[model samples]
Target: MTFSRVNAARGLTLAALLLAASGCGAKNTPADASRAEPDPLAKLQPAQDMAAYRAMSDLLYKLDQEAIQRELTETGQEKSTKPAKDKLFGFDATRAVHDRDFIASGEGKALADSLLTYQTPSGGWSKRTNMSTPRKPGQQFGTEKDYVPTFDNYATTTQFWVMANACNAHQDSRYCDSASRALSLILLAQYPNGGWPQSFPLRGKYHDDITFNDDAIANLLKVVGAAAEGDERLAFLSDGLKAQAKHSLVRALDMLVATQVEVDGEPTIWGAQHDDETLEPTSARAFEPVALATSESADLVLFLMTLKNPPENIRKAIDSANRWFEKHQIHGLRYRRGDELPALIPDDDADPLWARFYDIESDRPVFGDRDGQVYFELEKISAERRAGYGWYTERPYKALKEYRKWQQ
Candidate 1:
């Protein structure tokens, strides 16, 4: 849904409040309320040691505050990364995403504390929120269910892994507690069938679908799979979290195999998104058609091959998709809608590539635009969308190369 003017106003208020709680605001709360205390986070910078961590965290929050304010007042300063129409919660302070800097400094601790404020009772956080700002005590924010957390833009999963890294480096109890809660939320948000919905405490839109767009589900697999195999950064994860993540990975693969699109009764590739209940390819945005998608499936196939001693079914699925990739490959064409004379000019040796979408029945490439119009030829799509969307990619080649090694 498009964020209306009214929602935009509401969103700014909530965004500012949450950003303050995440340690981004300029002013510090008085420790005892009556007496003034020195702000420990004044003029901080990114650091690895405890003393530097303190100052670094303060500085990080300060910068974060500036980014949030700029987003609120300026035009086109902070476009939503993974918009959910929640105005306030949907947008993030899209500034320099200094994950390493944030984690190393003392400000990182306050950042973790701020993360707790955003976490819903369900243990997950709202999707597409700025994580740098700290939450204030007794802070009241979010109109309606605007505060419910989700998995989009790698929300809960990202939080879990980052705090896990902090816990590993510093072994701080607060960070550990935060990471533990994130793990609990991760297990809670999972569907019984192993697929993860785009949002938890779902808002009942396409967000409820078992998502593959932007590599959402596959990213989850990598994190949990690493934890299962005992990645040292996340070695502190409880045995129970590891077991749950391992089992969750298995269940997710089942959905993956079940959701593979087949043309003429032969399994081929996958759709960018799928129905959570039916395991069928489903349309997401207006322009996102229900067809065999090469982008996300490329990531998924590579992930599947990472598993050791895969079941025969998975092996067959991988082989089938590779064949599909080989068959549908586009050649000798650049963006046909480019600003140049011939929108699509053929290069002598343009390497084999794939279209983002393909016709389910015809097996030919397809394109769509914000107008919800579908076109068979790239030149037929609108100029804006043709320029904006990635209709062509070499990402599939990464999977194809990995498959060669996996075969050996």
Candidate 2:
């Protein structure tokens, strides 16, 4: 059912308010508000975590800018790591672009410029390169996967909307031309049943399965809404995208609801990578559901509440999931996502095995595939995974422990 514009606007407002509460330093109630002193966060302006995020954004911006200027030589390469025409700028240079505070900074403009250059003749970018490079800090990661080529219609279509929006937000029109092309691509990619696949193969190879990838199409539809308001370039399909995103999200949400599992009273969401043929839910592959109260399940519920006009069912799910999280929160420098489990087989005198997933009602831990298999009985894993219980586990586990306290 389609929501009226007035109702949708109200829903969006409520969602924005919920999102604000989710950020950090939200007070519990107005009655408690009188006695409670304002948190430091409540008084301060929002700022990006400059040290880590800046360098990465800067590097990404510079690379994009160079690509836009046509300064690099293009060899029509098929691989992710194809060398640019110019001498490669060091990774440090790219990182420097992100050093600025705002996404609207000069570096951002440069990125918009670069993205503009890559739009294909068909109004979308083919897989010239992959954005993420899993490299050590200071190293430029390279991609070996060519999963998102222009020839792949769904991928290209989504990229077109993303690039267009990212560029438009920075007031750069260079990306406008590409955005128009992408609108054309979207019209071509839509399915008869109002679903979208990740790729569009021209040579009679049909690949259609709805998953998280479809979320990209949903987001693109919002962009198309903006395009239709006479922003030109890609204005043609703005109405189409808005309609499709609403239809697609509803379809996707139904599929997700059908896949949810309940353990005791708590609910868990499924991750992708289930058994395709049998449609069986697999272990935590990609955002797979876990029992309620565990950090995994609770966090999912918390995130879902931020959606505009969240359904009554979704609200109930979030409430149950969060109640479990609130009760089981570990308090201290050392904490686990949930209660720890005794190792089925001992590893050392002090080291006891633990499950990553926890049961809120039973007060037990849910082990993974490798939770008790004998190969690890004599073998040793890194301390990072065994953090909180181990003698020395500091980085993220410690940070997580601290954050949990704030949630309480």
Candidate 3:
């Protein structure tokens, strides 16, 4: 569920292209037509607002670089302090409230109260905020100042689950009302194209992109599907609300099939994020370049596999992504988390590992640093990024395992 940043050189290229497109840069060179590689995403027509999206992405990249530079200039290096466990809060609280008895318990009531207090005016919860404590006056709903209400990191959806369960246990109008508002946020945040953004009330930059990073969109889809299917937790939803959930579910499913990344006219897996309108792969944070994201893609595949008697297109998409996983898995080495930095230890008997990002064209494992340099080897990136981010994952094995059973 970790998200990385992008390569700065690639950002410069994209910025240059934007400038050239706007007639603000020198052009008319015709010497290298033979050397230019055709764009793999050309067939997937860009959205009308693609230029704006790219411009914003470029701007964010620059701002990120500037911020990092400032920190390094002032402090000699970027600070890396891990927050205390009590300070780090997310879906774990909701996950622990599994039964009706727990929901009726005093501790559960306190948790529900804290969640209700923190629910933003827009009806969604913020990521990583300490929901164990009640909101203070004049405090932002989110833990981070810049982050608005979001579905990222199991935020709003998880709160919705907790509230719904609380409603079921106590028949409290407060819990039901809160859960309903959260559900409304889920339905409203989805783009007309049926993809969900990382954060809503449309916080521009990459936050406005159609996000799958940390399974943001995928998690929302699960909640929507559950509501549509009349899940007991959401039994309080009105028929009208349930119908809306059903329609949202249908559009999102179609979007899932349509947005699968393509290379050389063949569908591959998905990227961590996509253009909100174009549905083409796009970059997120500075180190998370536009590439085939194995971890997020595996989650999508698992979700698709859960569909009973899936249509031909859904089945095809699943099969194609599964094949992509099989084709791209790293072998003969295992990812090791070292005290100093992570390493790929040589072990022939080790299970296969998948890089978090694979180059869109070459399919080689890609690593990126806060400086925006993309490297083919993990050793090439900064030690800070190497130790901080999860650059490789074993998540795809679960998807492939499920696929084998699904085939049978």
Predicted structure with the largest lDDT when compared to the true one? 3
lDDT of 3 at 244: 84
Q: TM-score for all predictions?
A: 0.70, 0.43, 0.77
Residue-by-residue lDDT tens digits, candidate 1, 1-408: 355565455445434533443442223221111112222222111122323222322333344334334434433433323222343243232211236556666766555556655544234555545544543332221223433456666667766666676676577765665676566555545666677777654556687788888787877787767767676777777787777777767777787788898777999998888887788889877788888888788998998898866789899999999888877777777645456522556875766778889989888888887878888988888777777777877778889899999999
Better of 2 and 3 by TM-score: 3
Name the weakest run of 10 consecutive residues (lDDT summed) in model 3: 25-34
TM-score-wise, the better of 1 and 2 is 1
Give each prediction's root-mean-square deviation over alpha carbons: 12.8, 18.0, 15.5
Off by over 4 Å in 1: 1-102, 107-116, 136-147, 336-344
Best by TM-score: 3
Task: Mark the 10 consecutive residues where model 1 has the least summed lDDT.
Answer: 30-39
Clashes of each: 19, 21, 10
Q: Residues 312-337, candidate 3, lDDT per residue (tens digit)? A: 98899999999999998889998899
